[model samples]
Target: MLEGRSCLIPRPPLSSSGDQESTCFYMRYGIIKEGSEEEEEDEEKIDDRGKRRKSQDLVIASSSREIQIEQTPHERNDYSSVEDLIAPIGRDISINCLLSCSRSDYGSIASLNRSFRSLIRSGEIYKLRRRMGIAEHWVYFSCNVLEWEAYDPYRQRWIALPRMPPNECFMCSDKESLAVGTELLVFGKEVTSHIVLRYSMLTNSWSPGKEMNSPRCLFGSASLGEKAIVAGGTDARGNILSSAELYNSELQTWETLPSMNRPRKMCSGVFMDGKYYVIGGMASSTEVLTCGEEYDPIRGVWRLIANMSSGLKCASGAPPLVAVVNNKLYAADYASKEVREYDKVNNSWITLGRLPERHVSVNGWGVAFRACGERLMVIGGPRGLGGGMIELNSWIPDKNPPLWIMIASKHSGSFVYNCAVMSC
Candidate 1:
């Protein structure tokens, strides 16, 4: 095939006014066309689509025509601080929710910061706040060395309170112990068995109360209204005695009551309705005790109730269960761990439930009560030789088992003679 050869193209030349002319090369791909200087100046100012265009200064750019839009800041004159934003303005909000929402508030944030700083500076606020929610129980017990110990259930710990001001003689020997409100009333001393010592848990302090009519110890102490009644225990010479005495809290004095049929010591006492029960303990001999009797404070007389299946002895660390529920008396034998629930209507002892776990040495004094959370907490015995407290719990089974969680263990000097529990 025959073909013509292509030729080279020349660009337009520059003008003479000191401005160099642009090299206007008419190019189509690689093919270009030569243009004369006059031809370029004569060409009209037209776009490739044959549209007229304004001069550079008068031309409006498409991008510039677009409206300049922007988002404004959320400025609120009504709210001067974060607290204004978070605080409830007549709004019904839960305390928890309000607290959460208010945490971000300026005042709350600042206060929290200041509190943390203060706690760090004090070094005790954190610990105090941590213990604010601890569940606790207080029980009084007497040991040999440690005259008295108070067991707390929440920490499962034992705290040794102040001993009697006097450390010697029969002052340490509390033949009978009774809990009146938060104060522990003990009757019987060496000089005169009728002397009484009242220990207040709130103050963790002690004070001397009035003495009984006769010198007595190891007696059964009970309460009727504001007055305290003491039944059989022992005489001044360590003899099994059948004598009863009464102490008037209002009068701050003592009176005597009719003695029991037989002399007894370490007997279990329970006040139900308006009557007092002196359950199985022991006579003058070391033999076991099975007989039980009740006394009416109103009538000033004693009536024999149903006796326990097993005799309760003082050697058992603590006395048998003496709980009054729904105006009925219930006794628990520590030796057998068998609980006898007394039906007031039938006037008899029936088998109830067993303790989840058995306890070790009981301190003749045991404390028990129904706590807020549907649980019954029981703290027993002083720390034998070592100063400590044993605590336990009871509840309906299949749920969480009632447990005795230890809160405190310490070197309490001695285990006193009597023990009882009272709520603060």
Candidate 2:
């Protein structure tokens, strides 16, 4: 396993000679900027429980940080890197065409050289890749009942990952997954305690990440670029946790965050409008909670939001998967059989559309719903009735009279636990 480094990715440097090749790279891809002062050091406020907040990750996923590693064109003349390979194709069109490769090919490309590895790991690649209109997004799914698999929506194929690590008495379904930097993080209880496993796209291998401070099941989680937040789940003793924590992807560290006002489990989390919102869950195994809370990482505080009176009121009773797009929050309410968008300004929910029809669609447990690029997708099947096939359906809200499109389907022995998207 590769060790974590500074979360910041170094910007490519132009040769001092101002060579034609270097200038071409500059013309196609401009320099990326640093974060503003407010984003860097906004308000170092204390949490409700009186604890200081940790520093935000590099640039909260959109930008890099100050720790620079100079990779001038002349400095890399001796070794061939992905930059070198693409340097000749300085123009945007050819670079994007090369970038539109299969997801399974990234690991080999990254291993070509130091330059290729560094370029593949940087956020700049993602920005450039998207701008060129050649960015391809792949979805990783953990059935929780078996092993992990990734789907290339563009190619309509399934790629198997390494079997889920060490599963004697462990089942990973009650888990949460997110993409922080280039790794896929899967966290949840493994038999007795909460464990985390990190999957590297560059290495195409699985390794253990930092374990959770508290062992939890049915917790809320969301990604913040280079870092991620997970809150409110049931502990080993079946106690709902008010406790929350943050994961520093670069340091591979887990730090405790301020606990919530009330204990909750099986909650849904969505990062929207610069804050993290955790929705409806259960305080105990049997008691369902109607309230929700939003946390501002900048102010380091949590404010209570409106109570959830809509469908999927209980966490365990429904899947309660939440996602964000266009600065709005949308969730899959399995109980209602409809996906709803939450309007923070109006404090109301307007029905957006319905989930793909399934025999047992009324209940959404084991189903996974997440945002992919500009679209929202849900993956699950009505397996409860008997062994059935799984489905991947997606929606683009910008379209008039939005309709759900079934992207792919597969026969499976179990339901999905968690899902994440990577734009490579």
Best by lDDT: 2
Q: Encode model 1's per-residue lDDT on 169-250: one tens digit a residue.
A: 4444455667653457765566633566777432345788666667666666655334567777777777876777776654
Across 205-312, the per-residue lDDT of candidate 2 in tens digits comes to 678777877757678887766577889988776777888888877577888888777788878787888788788888776777777888888888888765653555
> lDDT of candidate 2 vs native?
0.61
Clashes of each: 25, 1
Q: Model 1, stretches more than 4 Å misplaced?
A: 1-138, 142-160, 170-175, 191-195, 200-204, 306-309, 314-319, 345-347, 356-358, 362-376, 381-389, 392-416
The TM-score of candidate 2 is: 0.70
The whole-model lDDT of each prediction reads 0.46, 0.61
Clashing pairs in 2: 82-116
Name the lDDT of candidate 1.
0.46
TM-score of each model, paired residue for residue: 0.54, 0.70
lDDT at position 296, candidate 1: 75
